[model samples]
Target: MRKGILIFTLISFLLLNTPVLAQEPLNNIDLQPFLKLTMNVTLVNTGEYPKFIAVNPTYDFKTFREGDEYLLHNTTDLIQLSKANLILNKRVGFWIYPHEVLKVEFSINIPMDLGELYLQDYADLCYPDYTITWSTKRITYPPSLGVGPLCEVVYPHLINYPILVDLTSFIQVRDPEIVIYSYSGEVEFTITNRGPKTMFAVALPLIPVDAKIYSITPNPDMNYTEYMGKFLPTYLKSQVQNAKFNLTQESVLFEYTDTLLSTMSSQQNLIQNSITTNEDIVDYPIWIVVLGENSSFDIKYKFQWEFTR
Candidate 1:
């Protein structure tokens, strides 16, 4: 009777410790989101036998049925997995035996940068069929471009460039005066032109790497009337209705011409000749033509660039 009671207690303990299989089918499961491409998953098998879970590959990722530490230190295992051309689509199971839980971790070597990645596991035990979805969040950014010191990240993310221009002459323009800002896939250049010249035609020589030049429109808040009044007053004569400009792959050119007028008269004994051009002229990527003899203007140009990959 004592032996029988001890056996009952043992069975009760086993029942309490082991994970119970759900009566209904487990169709879906969501895993924790990770920042990096690699993640570790713990799969529990409460079924009667060993089952296979097929992982769907994303971004041409390869799978190896090995743990992180073992894959690194164990050269034999690494070579074996490397040579093993496991059919990605048909690659079945990181085996979990009955009443057992297995922890499997894997890494993906992606060809290009990824913002967020979604991974899945299709596990069908026939008895309890299920699918598990895992996602990675863009919480952190690794230096995927390169590990070198000079490596730059130029994705269409939130970025700002502080611009300062103080030039007595064009030769003193050693740095750029325009600041490029990209937010929510829209690119904008916040430009402030200040110096001793009436800007006629402005050009941006260098742009962000891998960014294509496209048509840009002035922001509505920007005072176009005031802009033309200070710099190209000649454009007003032509009845400038709207802001117009052109761009090239390498440079952004302002589609406006410089206007100059001169009047001279030679009569009998007295002769008078006058040529009007501002002396306070400085050349910059942003061009300006002086409107008056003592003309000096500070203009701000804010425009947006629309582009794709």
Candidate 2:
């Protein structure tokens, strides 16, 4: 009887000292409906280096919660160093947060004069997947709801990357832009040695809407590629059987075929395959794919595109 009373007393004493969810950290996060990018930099050597490589154009902004690390795409054209010298420890945008303008930077092997630097040689900024975590709870961002864009991601899933975001139709929303005449038979272009010697010709590869092509009418300018095959259409479709299933959700991400030829599977009209026409996808995700040349040279271009859309 004495032992039982002693054990009960000890258990009651332990329970009294423990605290519950009443004192737990509260999560007061008011996530904005829109997403933005931001960056911050602390230069170790201020005036020591005159000019260095950078990634993004000015006027990019973001708001990230504390302890977020973003993966930045290191652009080759942004650096104008000696061919032998390499870049090291280059960092872009500190952490994106709401209402913060971001600047980008890179660590270089040759800390040369900034005036001797030329940013025109830098290639497009490319990046893979990145993550952002909200460490602090109170983040303020205004919601922005705009009209949906008109263009679709034209690249096949395997070869899709986006260097530009705004749609071709959307470009008309601006003024004083150069008119790109692409529908001509040949495009004549002249590349110049602005800062560096001629190493390679740069041109943006075009992704076809459907895989097959009857002809390619290049612009009147002279930018060219060597391995040009007769244009052909590639096939992509989320294939499905004419049956029902209880657990089809787990299996059907999407299926596609390579041969999108015009051969009829049925006696119906040859309807252009619509990939994102599902009734379920009320708000479809945006995908962009960019095809570029593989070269070890510096090139810039202003080419026009004309296609029978």
The TM-score leader among the candidates is: 1
lDDT of 1 at 119: 19
CA lDDT, every model vs. true structure: 0.27, 0.23
Segments of candidate 2 deviating more than 4 angstroms: 1-166, 170-173, 180-256, 259-309
Q: Which prediction has the highest lDDT against the true structure?
A: 1
TM-score of 2: 0.17
**lDDT minimum window of 10 residues, candidate 2:** 26-35
Q: Across residues 1-309, which tens digit of lDDT does each residue of candidate 2 receive?
A: 432333344223222322112221211111101111121332122222233233232222222333322332234233233222123355332322232322322221111111121112222122122112334433343353232443232222211111121113312212222222221111121222222122222232211122221222221122111111111121223232232323322211111123221212234444333222112211111222122322121111122224234
What is candidate 1's lDDT per residue for 77-117, written digit by digit as tens?
Answer: 23223323333355732344576655555433221111111
| TM-score of each predicted structure versus truth | 0.20, 0.17
Off by over 4 Å in 1: 1-36, 57-79, 82-92, 113-309
Worst 10 residues of 1 by lDDT: 158-167
